[model samples]
Target: MSKIVLYWHPMSSATPIACALAELGVPHERVKVDIHAGEQRKPAYLALNPNGKVPTLTVDGAPMFEALAIHLWLAGQYGVERGLWPAEGTPERLQAMAWSTWSYVTYGAQLVRLQTARDMGTPDDPHGQAGHKAMDELLALLDQRLASQPWMLGANYSMVDLIVGSVIGYSAYIGAPVQKHPHVLAWLGKVQARPAMQIDA
Candidate 1:
């Protein structure tokens, strides 16, 4: 087994990775980087992740960063055997990859914008409005996808649901209009109810 070490902080973007680790039952070391204390910018942590971000994982001492990349890699590497990830080269795998990327690139981007607007106390501004609209449309798309299914990749809850659901759950927590989409809200509730999602990491 490869020795894995996770560098993370509490309640930040790294939480999802921690949750994934828990779900996979992967035994690893955890190093808490206090971002509030600016430990992330220190030279040692920067050596692992030049972006100076948490959620950096070192597998056999080789470092990898970014929550999306880490999640996908974890699912591919460990999730297949556990049924958390779809097998490669299949339609379900393709959908999993697509939705996973969409969660980060598409929905996550708009969520950041909305968060920025709110942080600036300008949620009613044009940029904020645009972000809100984009989020609504994205959530509607997710809603439609879930209208007939309970999970993102269909009947079973897989890593795809966890990946996308984490972002959607965070959006709702940060005051996104996720409540407007009933299917999404319901699906998110299911995701959150998982024991892995309940881990405080």
Candidate 2:
């Protein structure tokens, strides 16, 4: 077994984490739980996370549930070794960390709303409204930020983008008109274009 065991569901919220592990170039064992089949509610998985969400990283014998926390741990531990995260506690890195946190709460929640609608087989109005409201705010923020820096962390591809961008892409995937936000659209294209992220790879 690999040192890192990831519990995930394909196309679920945990997908981005798999992408991050790929970027880290570390071998990880992916144990898929069928959320669609209600396997996430099973007793076995509930022991690890009471919420029964996927993307829990079992590291050093501890289970971490939150996406940002797992991403931060991966970045803090493997990022510096691989030069992905900014130096520890530096202003630039901390700013990136702030963006990462924002992504989970703001953008991430919006995407979750979209996904919820998709899962419910509805046309996605109320959730779309929530997502659009979030997009409007975050897109503007990102546009203004990108106006100055090439990447989220001042021209470098830091863990912030990896975590946030992964969660945000669900908007576009669920038929969000992200093209309206040119900066965000461009940013998504840039991040998705990474060699590690390509589907056929």
Best lDDT among the predictions, by candidate number:
1
Residues forming the 10-long window of minimal summed lDDT in candidate 1: 168-177
Candidate 1 runs further than 4 Å off: none
Model 2 lDDT per residue over 75-190, tens place: 88888878888888689778877899888886767766666777788645787667666766776787788777677887678777778787667677776666777777788888
Q: TM-score for each prediction?
A: 0.98, 0.87
lDDT of 1 by residue, 45-152 (tens): 999999998889999999999999999999999999999999988999999999999999999999989999999999889988899999999999999999999899
Clashes per prediction?
0, 0
Model 2 C-alpha RMSD to native:
2.5
Worst 10 residues of 2 by lDDT: 192-201
Highest TM-score model number: 1
